[model samples]
Target chain A: MLSIKDLKVNIEDKMILKGINLDVKPGEVHAIMGPNGSGKSTLGNVIAGKEDYEITGGSMEYLGEDLSELDVDERAQKGVFLSFQYPVEIPGVSMSNFLKQILNTSRKVRGLEELNPMETLKFLREKVNMIGMNEQMLKRSLNDGFSGGEKKRNEILQMAVLEPKLAILDETDSGLDIDALKVVAEGVNALRDGERSFVVITHYQRLLNYIVPDYVHVLHEGRIVKSGDKSLALELEEKGYDWIKDELAATV
Target chain B: MQQTVIDINKEAYQRFDALFGSFEASLNGQKSNPFHQIRQSAFEKLNTLQFPTLRHEDWKYTSVQRILKHKYVLEDTSMTISSLPEVAKMPDVDAIRLVFVNGVYQSHLSDNLNQVEGLSAFSVEDAMNHEVYNKVLSSRLTSEVDENTNPFFQLNTAFSRSGMFINVDKNVVIEKPIQIVHISQSGDSPKLSAPLFVFNVEQSAVLNVVESYISTETNSENPVLNTSHCFYNLAKQAKCNTYKLQKLSDDHYLIHDIKADQDRDSVFTSFTADLGGAIIRNNINAIHGDENILTNLYGVLLGLGTQHVDNQTLIDHAKPHCQSNEWYKCILDDRARGVFNGKVMVRQDAQKINAFQQNNALILSDTARMDAKPQLEIFADDVRCSHGATIGQIDEDAVFYLRSRGLSRRDAMLMLQLAFLQEVTDFIEHNGIRDFMVNNIVSSFEKIV
Candidate 1:
């Protein structure tokens, strides 16, 4: 469902992501693990069409269409979702209003009728229950003073409400406690309906145990140097990322 | 041949001088009235003081060249209006409506004074002639005699022919608000109207006043210039809330002066929203008469196009244990300019006073400008006084965050801007007025950016 061929990206004059290639089929979960500054989050942001990074070379395709043609909002409307490492705290827009706006706009773009206020509330309440978020939180501003765990859980709640075709979780488990991580993983697990796909980017192998990726890839520098089944996660967890750096140096 | 702004201003002064003569002559038998001395002194002060130039610190950010370049109809005859303009209508607000067209009170459109209990309304002539009301107007007018006095207020005092005198009896609470609508309209040249409003809330009384300024026509070449002033005097333990909504045409001009005094344990809260007009200025001053006064001065402004909104506020703590809170927020876009100057003073004997003042501004366009100055003077030994000013742009990161969630760029910007203003509007306890103001402010902001 998603393909990247020799993709190169840059911020200002500095190269962040060097040449890389990857592919994922529908209904598959691909976990990319790397040390800090290894371009794991850069790849997710590139797919989400963030404005800072310039795609210096190559092409990325989703659903047989070029991803560069869509704006950030257009990409979101076309079912490309990115769960930010730090969800922004918007102090004026209420959570319910934000959720309702995104849902209705995405629905209209996808050729669905806009939900009435009652239906929207009902839809939001079910998603709220699925994520175990406080129902009263909707009355407050969007993440104005939410706890770290609550912020991560709020991202998952947004992901559930939007129901994107391809989701990118960028360090979603970094700030979560074990219980919060369990809840977030369960929320993601519930949404894994055969056709929906995910690219899970994480620094630790613990999240893989909850979501259970179909494949694991070790990103070093900018390229995906290693790819294997779920067992690779256990190996990396035991050996640490230094094992991948040593192997790359020996190969070079 | 083109005329310079200087020559146009000279012409304006000559026109004002001529109009003052007509005003004095028209007083007829009332030339010996008690207020005549106040008018004579004000006219002398007006002539002694030149029009404020940019070099002056008070007028540093705002230039009145745009106002001085035109000729106004200072001696316009009476005009007839069939009905109230749509802009002045408050459908959800149940109140006493007082309409003024071209500075003359239209009794036909206003509520009858005899119908309302514990309320007395009179014209300027009747009030100045009244023995009891004369002292109230006299003490307020002659109290401030300084070189720093604004020439516009002096102009209003010198030439104003029509105004209102409203009094609330002691221990009476006016259930409905008093809505004062100042409508400026002219079929020919730009008209200049100065109307005065004097309000006295007796001891233990409660009153709410909502004053609005609107123009029927919005011609850049022939807009109306409305120079109005209001005096609010609250007696001991009295409570008064004054709300001013200035939504004149974009080309119109308004200069309003609000003077208020609070006696012991009185509470005075003011809310001023400046959303329209080419150039508008509001000079608000509130002083403490005794101990335990609570004063709140809150203002919100949305400036677009070449519109300019300047709000100058002063809260004086003269007695012990008085508290004053002030918050002013402004949003400027498309070359609009805004200015906020808030001053809080604690006198020497005013111990244990708590005064807080804050000014926040959001500039949407790069060309949009805002100048905020907060001044605090505390001579008292023990007092808690604080002042702050913050000028910022729309958070680009917040915009990107909203856009990433499927909102268009415009929607994202509007959301952030609206949120920036909601903090101040949420303080309004009246839900209906808050919603009405929010709707109007949002619609105007949407049209700009």
Candidate 2:
């Protein structure tokens, strides 16, 4: 569902992601583990088409079409979702209104009929139940005063409503309690299907316990240094990134 | 222009001197009093002071260059209210009705809301002619006179022959609001309309006053100068709420002066709405007479086309433990212009005074302009006073978030604008007026959308 060939990205004059290549097929959940400054979030943001990062070289393709040329909203319409590490708080825009706008706009792009206010309200009730979100959250402004866990959960709820083809959860495990982590992972697992995929980016292997990945990639700097299966997550949790760095140093 | 000013200045003095000379002969020296003499002295003092030019500090934002060019005819012609251009139809006016046309009173169309007991309304001419009305005008106008930097007050007093005055007796609370309506039918011809309001509330008396200015006739592209001087005197522990809605024709020019004196423990709240006029200037002053008084001033301006609106407010904390608040918002579309200047002055003996001023504006179009200056002068050290101003366009992220939900770009923009203005509209105390404003806003939004 997603492919990247030596994608080099720069923010300002500094290089953030240099010569990185990766791929993920449908129904596959991939986890990328890296330490601080490993470009883990940068890779996800670039793929989601955030305009801040300049694509210096190479290309990124999603479902066999070029993704680098698309805008953030256009990418979102094509079923590419990004669970921001820090979701922006937009005042004066209600959460339900924001969610309904995104869902209907995305559906319209896919040739689906628009939903009335009543239909949209009913649609939101089921998704709210799935994430265990209070209905009051919909009445308030978009993430105006939400807690860290609530913001994360709100993102997951949006993912469920949009039903994107590929969702990149950028450090969704950070700043969340254990119970919230469990709920979020469960929400992600519920959305899993044969035609959908996910790229989970995290610093620890704790989230891997909930939503086990089919492929584990060790990202050292900007490139994937090693590729393995679920056992790799357990290994990294025990030894940390130092063990992988030592191994890479020896190989170099 | 130098030669022209010299000639116009001399002519102006001669014109006024001849007119007052005729009035003095007609009165036969009947006007005699310590306060009336003081008013006459102030009127004399105004003859030497020039009508403010653009070079003046207070008049810098609003230009009256065109008014200075034409010679205004001081006439006694009365215009019927039916001749006025219709906007929002006036509500059923069951209260006291005060009417002013071209700065003179029309007693035929006015009714005294306080005809029963402790309240009374009268025209200045009748007040000056009859002993009863003369006593009320002389006592109220000269007693609460604000002898400050404003020259318009002196100009109005000097030129005004007839004014309307309303007084609520001590300890008497008026149930219905007193309505003062000034209808102008002056065309491109230079005109001066000096309408006066005087309210004296005794201890514990409550009063609500709603005033409006509407032009009856005018050339759509020309200017008509209209001036007003209003004074409110609230005794100790008295409370008053005043609202001034300016919906005059965009072809009219206005100079409004509002001054209020609040006694100890008194409270005053004022809301001014400016949605019309080619050039509008407001000078509002509030003075706390004793300790522990509260005064608030709120306003909103919606300007379109080339209309110009300027609001200048001054809050004077004269005694200890006084509080004052001011907030003004302006939304400008097309090439309209808006200016706001709010100043708070805390006197030397005023300690523990709390004052806050905030001015915000939204520019809906690229050509629209807004300027805001919040000034504070504090002579006391132990006080908490703050002021801030912000000017910006619509929030892009907020717009995108709404657009992503399914609303078209236009609908989303309209929703954001409505939300931005909801705070000020919430302050409207009259449901009918509030709904009328909302309907106008929605209709205008359709064009902008």
Candidate 3:
């Protein structure tokens, strides 16, 4: 469903991603584990068509179509979602109204009829309840004053609402507690379907305990140095990333 | 520094002189009243004072040269009420509407004034003879003088003989808002419509007033100029809310002046929304007459095409324990220009005062301009006063956030613009009026896009 071949990215004359390659089939969950400054989040942002990074080499193909020419919104309309590590706070825009606009716009792009206020409320209430969020949060400004966990949950809620084909969770478990992490993982697991794919980027394997991955890849120095099964996550958690670094140094 | 001398427009002065003669003739028997003397002095002052130039600090961003070049007529009795353009009335508002054609109050188009209890609404000429109105007018006329030298205000006072006066009785709350609609139909001639409105809210009374300016001359080669003045006096513990909506045609110029005096423990709020006009200038001033008064001045200006909207506001905190908050936002598109000059003054004795002023603008086009100057002059040491002014394009981060959520670039930008305006529109106490204003702002934004 998604393919990245030898991706080299730079931002303001500084290289963030040197060379990266990843492939994901439909219904597959891929976890990308990396230490700090390993460019895991950059890959997720580039895949979501963020404009800040410059793709120096290679290409990204989503559903067999080149994504370099598409805008952020166009990519989103085509069912690509990125759950930000740090969500933006937009004041004066209520959460529900923001969601309704996005849902209606996406629907319009897909040649579907728009939902009215009542229909939108019903749909939002169901998703909101499933995520165990307070109804009052929907009336507040979109993530304006929300806590870190609340923002993460709001992001997951947006993911469920948008129902993207390819969802990228960029450190979604970074600032969440154990209980919050389980709730988020459960939310993500509930939305998983046979046709949807996810690329979860994280530094630790604690989140993998809740939502198991089909494949685990260790990203070191902007390159995917190791690829293995879900057992790799448990091994990394026990042995740490020093073994991977030592192996890379020995090969060099 | 050498003092520069301003040359007044001779032709414009001649035209104003002839119009003033006509205005005096229209007054007829009321020429002997003391108010007529005030009009004569104001006319004299207007004649002596030259039109403000770019050298003037207050008129730096705006120029009256185009408006002064035309020889405007005072009265256009040739046009009938049916010839005026239709203004969509707000739905679900049980308002008492007073319609005026060419600055002349049209009783036929107005609702029955007798239905309102504890309220006396009449033409200025008729109200001058009543004892209650005379008492209020005599005391307010002296207090109503403009603090600054503005030629338009003097000109409006000179020619505004046929105006309206409303007096609310003590402890009476007017359930329905009084809607004053001023429609200018200058036909082919470049006319000047000057209307003066006076409102007196007695002690413990509550009143809501809305004044809307509109024009009907769609094909006139020369632009019509409408200069209107409204004076509101709120007595002790009274509450007054006034809204001024300027939606004239693009071929017109509007100068609206509103001054309110708040007595002890009274509250006064003014909302001015400028949607359309070639050149629109609103001068809103408020004064605290006694201790513990609250004043709010909020406005929104949406300018498109070559529109020019200037808002000059002053909140004078002369009494102790008074609080005033002022917020004005503008959205300028195309080559439109917006100007905001807000001043807050805390007198020496006005201790324990709180005053805040903010002006924000979004310049949507390369040629669009915004000039915002927020000034605070506090003579009292024990006061909290702050002012802020921002002139910028749309927030790029906010735009990107909206776009990333599936909105197009244009929709995202428009949504952010509306959100910026919503900060000021949320201050409207009446929901119907707020919605109407928001809808108007949205439609205006659509035109800009």
Candidate 4:
């Protein structure tokens, strides 16, 4: 469902992602592990069509359509979702309204029937309950004065409501307690299926325990140096990233 | 030192001298009437009071030199109050109707409000002819004029010809707000009109006044100037709410001076929304006269084109245990400029006072300008007084966040502006008034974005 060939990205004229190649098919989950400044989050943002990053050279195809030609909203409409590392607080837009707008916009862009207010409300309630958020939280302004855990849960609720084809979780586990991490993972696990795919990006392997990725890739200096099964995450967590850095240096 | 002193009060003295020489003898003859005597005293106080300048801490960012330099001819005779344009078609609001055309009462356009029990509403002419009007003004306009803080108010009394007077009897809760409509019309020439409005709330009585300014005809080349002074008096245990809607055209300049006095256990709430006018200056002052008094003031100014809106507010806690809250917001687009100055003062004896003030502005374009200053002066150390001011563009992150949800860029900006101004619009107590305010806000947004 997602494919990238020699993806290169530059921010402020400084190369962040150089020659990154990855592919994820439906019915599978992929996890990317990298140390600080290893270009893990930068890859996710570039895929999500952030305008600040210049895609120097790349061909990214999602669901048989060229992703580079689309803007952020267009990419989102095509079932590409990015869970931001930091969820922005919009002071006056309610969570339910924001979620409804996203869902309807996505549906409309795909030539699907749009849900009415009542139908949207029902969908939002079910997702709210599934994500363990109170109805009052949905009524308040989006992310305004919300705790870190609540903001992460809010992002997960949005993902569930939109039901995107490919979701890139970027540091959703950071700043979350163990309980919050489990809740967020549970929300992600609930959406796991043969027709949906996920790209989990994190430094720790703890979130992988709950989401349970099918493949693990170690990213270093904007290149995927190692690729293996789920056990690779466990091994990297145990020995840390230096072991992989040493192996790459020895190979070079 | 002598040169500096002379330069300090140059503009103020010129204005004072012009007004004094124009109407000193006429005001002296009308002192036999108590209201006229009060007016005369106010004129004397205007002479003693000095106009604040950039040196003043609160007026540091605002410049009023141009306003003071122009010698405005205060017209006494009534100008033609032409029929208003059919654009603003609102249903008849069931309240006491008072009409002022170029600062003169237009009896033809007013309804007979005397039939309403316990409610006395009429133009200054009605009060001038009736014996009971003297009684109402004598009991209502009973304020010892403050010279320093409100010099323009005294000037209003010194120059105002006819005024709007309303009295809600004791223990009578007025359901429908008293509506006073002031309309300015452009004729063959430009004109200047100064009107003074007074509303007296008896003990335990509730009064809501909806005062709106509308222009019947707008001529850019021959524009008119309309200045208004309004004083509100709430007795012990009385409640009063004032909502002023300024929707004049771009061909008009309005200067409004509003003074409100709250007695012991009284509550005064005011919401001022400025949507029109070429240049509008609003000066609002609320005084908590006794202990346990409460005061709340909120304002929103949405301007487009070359419109300029300036709001200055002062809340004085004179007695102990008073509370005051102030919030003002503005949205400016094109070449519009907005200014806000909110000052909260807690007196020495006014211990345990609680006062909070916030002034926030959002500039939509690079050419738009916003000047906001929130000032707090606390003589008593035991009071809770805080003030904050912010001038910034809309949050880029929030805009991007909304745009990612498929809202067009223009729609996202309009939503943000609406939410920013709704904080003040929601303070309208009456449903009809609130709807009117909402519609006005939406129209202003439409013109800009």
lDDT of 3 by residue, A46-157 (tens): 9988889999998899999999989999999999999998888877777887889988888898999999999999999999988878888988988898999999999999
Native-to-model Cα distance after best TM-score fit, residue B205 in candidate 1, in Å: 2.2
The predicted structure with the larger TM-score, 1 or 2, is 1
Scored on chain A only, each candidate's TM-score is 0.98, 0.98, 0.98, 0.97
How do the predictions measure up, each by TM-score?
A: 0.95, 0.74, 0.95, 0.84
Compared with the true structure, what per-residue lDDT tens digits does model 1 show for residues B246-342? 8887888899988888999999999989989999999999999899999999989999898899998988888999999999999999899999988
Worst 10 residues of 4 chain B by lDDT: B83-92
Best-matching candidate per DockQ? 1
Query: What are the lDDT scores of the predictions, listed in order?
Result: 0.87, 0.78, 0.86, 0.80
Where in model 3 is the C-alpha error above 4 Å? B1-8, B25-35, B83-87, B142-148, B184-186, B216-220
Clashes of 1: 0
Displacement of residue B349 (Cα, Å) in model 2 is: 3.1
Question: What residue pairs are clashing in model 1?
Answer: none
Q: Per-residue lDDT for B260-363 in model 4, tens only?
A: 87889999989998999987888888988899999999899988898889898889888999988888989888999998878788889999988988888998
| Candidate 2 chain A: worst-modelled 10 consecutive residues by lDDT | A88-97
The pairs that clash in candidate 3 are none
Candidate 4, true inter-chain contacts retained: 0.32
Clashing pairs in 2: A101-B404, A101-B405, A101-B406, A102-B404, A102-B405, B96-B113, B127-B133, B127-B134
| Stretches of model 4 off by over 4 angstroms after superposition | A24-28, A62-69, A100-117, A177-183, A189-196, A209-214, A229-231, A234-239, B1-112, B115-117, B128-162, B423-439
